[model samples]
Target: MHFSLPDIENMDHRFKVNFINSLSGFKSANLVGSIDKNDQHNLAIISSVFHLGADPALMGFINRPDSVERHTLSNIIETGFFTLNNVTQSMYKQAHQTSARYAKTESEFDETGLIPIFSNTIAAPYVEQSTVRIGLELVEQSQIKYNNTHLVIGKIVEVIVQDNVIQNDGYIDIEQLNTVAVSGLDNYHTTHRLERLAYAKSGVQPKPLII
Candidate 1:
């Protein structure tokens, strides 16, 4: 369960990929949207949704160096508005296809046959088929020199979720939505909620504490 940097460097490419994939099981699928100055729109379907627990409803994702089309970054800089769409099992393939490096003039929504729904609060478009769509405003962006990756932080302005998928306890049921998670490069998986745990500070003593 332990791997040193040297050990990772010594491993084969496939092994390194699998090792990193295992380490990144905590991520979630999120579709990021932005509109260029010329009005061209772009989206990057990402599997990295980290820093979601911070106050002020913050979320972030990493954009790889080679994957830079710059439209999304430019739009965020200009308008400070973007949207995050949570992909479901039914839209998995289409969502994945949006990762293709298409021309700036091309809209991934049009290319993937996904419907673009106008956001009531934000100007950016969101995937209509997604069970959860969030309108976000860009708060900050930082570029990492090590990997040439750009880390974008956004504040959730508005949240839209299907009524049926939300539980009475404020939990969104992934199984109900048939939401899929990504593994490695091409692997997709359906997520199932196994159990719910009480908050650490709830102080509710359980007859049998089990994780």
Candidate 2:
């Protein structure tokens, strides 16, 4: 299982891709929703969405190089707004299908039969079926020199979550909502939390904290 840099680079293209992707372990599965100036809605399944900062409510996700038609990133850039909807166990199939290369004129919502809903807060659409939804405004973007991938950063403007899942400490119980995780490129998995450990203090032994 040991692979050196040269060994990895010489591996089959698809094998290298999967090996590198899976090396990071599980990733958040989110459906990004956006719209163009003409109101052409686009839905895309993205695994790289991550938290940037809590004080500013910032979030970031990597955008593959725009060598091809990337509807989600293009729409977000064009409109300055986007939505992230957690993919649940029930809708993951439809969510994964959004990764397909559809024409810019085609709406993935319509193509995949996923319902799109809107609110007064932002212009981007949200997945009505998702248990947790986040609306964000594009604040910054930077291209990585080595990979040509762009880091898209956004500020969270609105969040829609079921009240029951929100713990008193402000943690959302995603496990209770059945949020699915992604590994490599194609595998979807359900998660079981091992424990909620108390914050570490210099000499204190780790202890489980109840939610």
Candidate 3:
């Protein structure tokens, strides 16, 4: 199954989108929470959230084109703060529902029956049902010239997770939290840890390093 540039470009729009999206493999599933000046809450499910840097604790996510009304993107721009809440096995249905287009005044929390939690550190709301919650402050945003999409980068200001999930080596066991992954546009998947390996070195095969 191979496709050239012309073949891909000529494919059906929906088929092309699904094919291209799935080619990237599993992506991190997160519920992006934001609020407008009026305190109107907005929630959205995004799969593109990715780590940018560790020193600054930076993260980034892609916002689809703003040709349509994008409440979550607008609210984040308005407030300069947002949250990335991990979608777990129990809450993925509600998390995916947040992707639906709703009126700016309508709160996805209310619409989807998901509880919203708040913190003193940032104004954005977090998913109370999520086991891993991260509050971030918007640091930079730029439009991708090729696709007209926007890349939103944020600095991690706060992380809410159970202490037991953190390993002694600074690794958080997301599998213990039942965090789910996304594939294509709507498929949700649970992952299994194959094995943790020691750092690779030249002329040396890595060995299992499970704690």
Candidate 4:
């Protein structure tokens, strides 16, 4: 299906949002945690984690202006700490429920009945049910005025992963975690590893192998 900006004028906001979100299906799923100045905790059910491939492991997520319930942007600015947790199929429902618009005083962790695990280094909490969790510290934040979205960039400081999920060669086997993928707003799906491609820049051709 082909879509154009003009076509959005005739479609409802919900449909447009779904259409755009589906385009991001190829990205990894992540749960972002932040704390407001009042010490109120906030969580963003994110599916995209943009990586910069640099030292300290920089990553980012875009927040929609209209959909953001808590002032997570301000919290990140003040605290410079956040956590990114990987969502699994077992926790998909609870993870998705974190997106609900609750009062700032309420914690999504409590509302969704998901366990919050305190980070060893950061003040923020991560989903205890997640197979993989990373503690992050804010490095930079940029606002995209046209889209009314904030781009949050952070450096990973700590990582926690299930032993079985990590392969001998240091590659993570996502399928073992039974991770869930998000498409659009309310749709969720599971993923499996198809193949593990060889390093193309190693100056040698290797046979492709399926995992």
Candidate 5:
């Protein structure tokens, strides 16, 4: 179970990738949708999405090394708009299919069995099947010197959620919508609400909220 850097470095490439990805535990599964200048749509499944800040509603995700051409990344850079759509049980199979290398002229939404839905103001498209969707405007991008990977960040400009899942305080009930999770590359999972707890204080023992 204990693996030093040398041991990890010596492991098989596929095994090492799976091990490292799984080590991050469960990650959010989303389909990033973007459109090129020609209006060709692209969708790619990514689990690296993370929240960066709330004031500007910023979020970021790690793009893999840029050795290969990434259509989704390129389109986002070109148009400055992309969407993060929650992958549900029904759409995960199609979502995973999007990872396959498709030609730049082809749309993953067309290759897979998914449909692309558009909004009035945003240039990018969203997955119509997703229960929770977010539109973001590109703000910052940083290149990781060590790996040649890029850290893509954006500010949330739009949101779409199933009305029944929205809470009074603004939390979305993901469990109710059956939003899926990704473990490593191929393994998918379902999650449940263990409990939402109140903020911990010095003297007040942390307790679960009864909501």
Candidate 6:
């Protein structure tokens, strides 16, 4: 199980890729939806979305090396808008299939059984079946020097969530919505509610967690 840098580099390509990718633990599974200038819609599954800041409601996601066509990224760059939808237990299979290669004219929504929904404020499409949906406006994009992966940042302009999942403290309960998580490239997992701890303070004993 112990693998040095040299050992890992020399291992089989697939094994090395899987091992390195899985090292990051579980990641948020989201379906990114976008539309081109011609109104061509695209939906793709990604797991690299991360929180940037709360004050501006910023979020970012990483697009893989530019070896192939990136419809979602392209549409976002072209139109300046995109939507991120949570991948729940019921739609994990259809969400994963969004990774398949399809013609530019074909949308994963039409190819798969997923439905596309729209809002008045944003031009991009959203997943109608998602329990939680986020509409974003493109803010910035940076390319990694070491790898060709692109870091795309967006500001949340709109959000749609199912009732009763968001708590009074502004925390979105993932376990309540049965939101799924992803590992490496393919495995999917369901979340369970562990205790939610209170903020740490200097001289006080910790309070009981909200469960």
Each prediction's TM-score versus the true structure: 0.84, 0.97, 0.96, 0.88, 0.96, 0.95
Residue-level lDDT of model 6, residues 60-179, one tens digit each, is: 999886422398888999999999999999999999999988888998999889999999999999998899899999999999988888999999999999668778878888777878
Native RMSD of candidate 4 (Å): 2.5
Whole-model lDDT values for every prediction:
0.79, 0.91, 0.92, 0.79, 0.89, 0.90
lDDT of 1 by residue, 96-148 (tens): 89888888788987899988888668888888888888888888899998878
Model 4 weakest 10-residue run by lDDT: 63-72
Residue pairs with colliding backbones in model 1 are none
Could you tell which candidate, 1 or 2, scores higher by lDDT?
A: 2
Give the per-residue lDDT of model 5 (tens digit) for 45-146: 998999999998999998896422388788889999999999999889999999888888888899998999999979999999999999999999989998
Model 5 lDDT, full chain set? 0.89
Clash count, predicted structure 1: 0
By summed lDDT, which 10 consecutive residues of candidate 3 come out lowest?
65-74
Which stretches in model 2 have alpha-carbon errors above 4 Å? 66-69
Better of 3 and 4 by TM-score: 3
Error of 5 at 121 (Å): 1.5
Question: For candidate 6, what is the TM-score?
Answer: 0.95
Which is superior by lDDT, 3 or 5? 3
- TM-score of candidate 4 to 2 decimals: 0.88
